[model samples]
Target: MTWEVRFSGFGGQGIVRCALITGKALSMYDNKFATMTQSFGPEARGGACASQLVISESRVLYPYVTLPGVLVALSQDSYNTYEPKLRDGGVLIYEEDLVQPKEDTGRVQMYAAPVTRMAEEIGNRIFANLVTLGCFAAITKIVSAEAMKNALPGLVPDRFLAVNEKAFDRGYEYGLELLETRPLSIEEAP
Candidate 1:
């Protein structure tokens, strides 16, 4: 299987870190081939930022996500920019707190999760990225929840280790719930 995932948002939203964690999880725990890349504007906050991933069963030859199979939009600006790039039938996961789906787009499957709310509920706003990652894991099954959990300590700072782990677990479970109700098919690209 091959997957190209794009995570985009404002600079301070942790798009880059999220991408890194994903790559690390794939490489270290899942034992899959993965590559990650990113682009960002000048400002640290409110600037456009995007992180891309390419994962495969064999050695990944490219590090860029040309036509993403999964797109994660963490802000309205991100939705506006990358939503058009998703391949037909691709999966899009967006932050419900910041974006309202464009009802007219029928080419892709979209899921909205309140990542910020989930993070806040877990008592740490910084874990929003982890929550979103969990959502991705749950929906895609690209990385197992066990692998993600095992990979966390290396990705997060020592001070935030515990809560971030909880946040990831919550997101993963939330994703799994969605999957149980609406499972995705694994057909080849048309």
Candidate 2:
């Protein structure tokens, strides 16, 4: 089976970095294979940014995520842009504080988590992407916690290592909480 995930937000939201870190962790530590690609705006903060991930247990030929199994949108613009492309029965996880999705897209399961608020509470609002990553990890178990721990040092710069680690851990735990409350089904996206 294969999993296609898309992460999108404004340029400085770390959407690309989150995709890369997840792909690398799955490839390096979890022993699962993955590929990642990204697109970003010219300006840093306000422009659109998107990253896609294709993951499988075996060798993956294609590198693009045409129909995402999971769509993580951290901003309203991103949500509005990618919502229609999500596969039926796919998952749409968004930041509750930043985005308000349409009434109900029955084809996709919707999850609204306050990742930005959680990150700010942790004293680093920039770690919202990491929080979202943790939520993804918990819901899917696509990458192991140990793998995430190992991937952190390489994914983040040395100066902000501690903060990044904390952010990752916070996300991981929050994801677990989400899982315990509402487990994600493994059914294929239609």
Candidate 3:
């Protein structure tokens, strides 16, 4: 099966890097194939940004996402912009501190976390992206935590590796706890 995922947020939030890391984890460490594409808005820093990744067990023919099955929205603007395009029965993940979903998510499944708040507990808010990635890994189980951790060394600066790993762990642990403590309303993975 193929999974199309979109990571969306304002610029300077490492939105594009999320796709890059996930693609690397799936393709290099998890033995899956992945293709990634990214977009940035015209505004300098706070503009909308998004990155798409297509992951499959086999080779990926297309480089762009046609119908995203997973949507990670780290900002209100991004959630509003991409939520409508999510495929039916898709999974939607968002930053609870930054985004708020509508009363209904249609047939889509929804999960939320305070990614930025979690990052602040570490060193800075910059690592929220990594935290979100970890949450995604646990919530989706598309890639193992070890694989995602393995793909991190080169992507993050050597000095900040430890902190980034901690951020990831925090999110992963939180997600695992969520799964274990709460019941999922959705039936299947999209």
- The prediction achieving the highest lDDT against the true structure is 3
- What TM-score does candidate 1 get on C-alpha atoms? 0.94
Give the per-residue lDDT of model 3 (tens digit) for 32-68: 9999999997876998999999898889887788889
Tens digits of per-residue lDDT, candidate 2, 1-190, equal 8989999999888899998888888999888989998888678677999999999989989888988889999999999999999988888889999998899847787777899999899887888888888887777777787787678786788888788777778877887777677667778643
Off by over 4 Å in 2: none
**Higher-scoring candidate on TM-score, 2 or 3:** 3
User: lDDT per model, in order?
Assistant: 0.86, 0.85, 0.89
Clashes of 3: 0
Q: lDDT value for candidate 2?
A: 0.85
Residue 55's lDDT in candidate 2: 92
Pick by lDDT: 2 or 3, better one: 3
lDDT: the better of candidates 1 and 2 = 1
TM-score for each model: 0.94, 0.93, 0.93
Q: Candidate 1: how large is its RMSD?
A: 1.5
TM-score of 2: 0.93
Q: For residues 1-190, could you state the per-residue lDDT of candidate 1 as single tens digits?
A: 7889999998888899888888888888888998998999778788999999899889988767888889999999899999999888888999999987799465887788899999999996778999999999999878887877777786788888888888988999888887777677654632
- How does residue 15 of candidate 1 score in lDDT? 91
Model 3 stretches astray by more than 4 angstroms: 42-44, 181-190
